[model samples]
Target: MQEIFSAILGDQLGPFGPLILMGTLGAVLILFTLPVLLKKKQDPLDRLRDQIKTSKDVANGKAPARLRYDNQKGARLEKYSAFLEPQDEEEYSAAQLKMIQAGYRSKNAVRMFHFAQFAMGLGALALGLIYALLKSAQQDMSPKSLVLTVLLPGVIGYMAPKYWVTRRIEARKEEIVNGFPDSLDLMLVCVEAGQSLDQAIIRVAVEIRAGFPALADEYEIVSHEIKAGKDKSVVLKDMAERCGVPDVASFVTVLIQSQQFGTSIADALRIYAAEMRDKRVMRAEEAANKLPTKMTLATMMLTVPPLLIILIGPSVYDIYTLLNETNF
Candidate 1:
């Protein structure tokens, strides 16, 4: 009965082997091709929306008509606008929407990044399957072995992109955080110069371009949204949330409160900027203090072992020589 069953299974898989191979290849091809197809379908809608938005902005005196129409020589502004849409729109507040617009150049790039991850996973699985088949051709292949060899690589490949995205987000957030204090200082200067809060934010965004490009980009978005007639408090709050940083959120909260109570914007900015700088300094000091502790394990593993090897080596070698000379 077992032999009969085995024979039946072998016969079924034999004729279908070529078909299975073809299907697997087709699946991988589709895995790569589908994203491109979907992006093509989606691009027109994105472009139309951006054009409408730009037109509205120009009509409202939010952005100059020239700014909307002026393209770098040979540049496709429509394509650029479509590419600049925010990723994870639902996750952003109005302020955050501005920041995302300013900071990330391509929303489609984000989507393509995710798609590339999936393609890599599929490719890894295909490679594993190919390797397994080739190896099996030279030896016996068990079901368990086949599953491990093929599936492991696929799973690892699939996870790589997710891990990469998470790391990138963290690194970007840190970059923004590191630049925040300087941006705040610039805002304070603008406020002191008699600019209104919104105007100050725009100026800071412009002024900090050379030094803190990421924060400048975020500020540019805030300026754009304000120009579009969004409520000031709402935009600030949204910006804080989108930034996903405690310091920026605290600063935004201060701005919102100051705006609500008609407090001095310059004073608020000055105080917050000082506090941020102090916190940054303390953080650096704390990190410096921890370095000795961090080095302790390495010191023991590296320094102590080398010292021991130097101190004990001659005695051990002499004993070995003496023992050898005396015979076993």
Candidate 2:
């Protein structure tokens, strides 16, 4: 087998040709076989239905079965969590909060996140070292180049999970912002229709779910928390913290103050909902106002040059022709 691989790849890969070929073939085999080995017995449709049912259960004041099972799964991670998770309380809390904001409320999410970073960094570092060794065997490599090649992948791999989490947080924030106005309008309607605040939230969650699932999910969680006999103020504050949106924080403040001062909740919702709509419109206008500035460079780069060339080409061509004729 070594001789066969050497005969096939020795010219391109040098002395390590057989070893590299076997390693590559082994990786490919794992890629193909791992999914089969890990295949689950549950049908995909059933899994999706289960998720939907879990949401419905929460909305109806029942504890989600999925969450109960997740607690059990979380216990498995707890055994090694000290190794997998950050030891600093502040750092761990910050990471957990980020995970929550990114819509991952699982107890094991932070543990899994740190574990992923470690696994990816270790794997990438190994691959990088192997590649550097292969390259060094093929050609002379400076120590600096070798160091860079080995460390760059490891650094990038370690940070990739954090980057993904940041992107998720941004995307979730944008979705919440876009949907908040609509949800507020729906809540306002529910409130005006004589439903209590808690009922209004549940209704709004169900009604706006098709269009704005993230915001709806937040509302659903609030409803579930409220149903569990938690203090309404604390639940609202928790929702704001989980959302990390200024608009939501303000809304929570409004609700809290209204309750404190004996103001009508319906009136508060009505006023705040209108303000939210205005804010949404203002955001749209602000984006539109910046459009011209954003497009100015693109317009010049793409349109002005072509126009200039079209206008001057014939004149330049005529001048060149006249100069040539005069010389002739």
TM-score of each: 0.69, 0.74
Instruction: Give the per-residue lDDT of model 2 (tens digit) for 151-180.
Output: 899899999999999999999999999999
Runs of candidate 1 with Cα error greater than 4 angstroms are: 1-114, 139-142, 324-328
TM-score of 1: 0.69
Give the Cα lDDT of each candidate.
0.72, 0.86
Q: Which 10 residues in a row give candidate 1 its minimum summed lDDT? A: 73-82
lDDT of 1 by residue, 1-328 (tens): 4455446445333333344456567877986775455453457889999899998998888975354443342243234333333445674344234334334444344444445566688889888887876666566666687778888998999888667666755766887888898888888887898888788888888887887676777788788999999998888887776677889889989988888898888889899999999998998999999999999999899999889899999999999999999996
lDDT of 1: 0.72
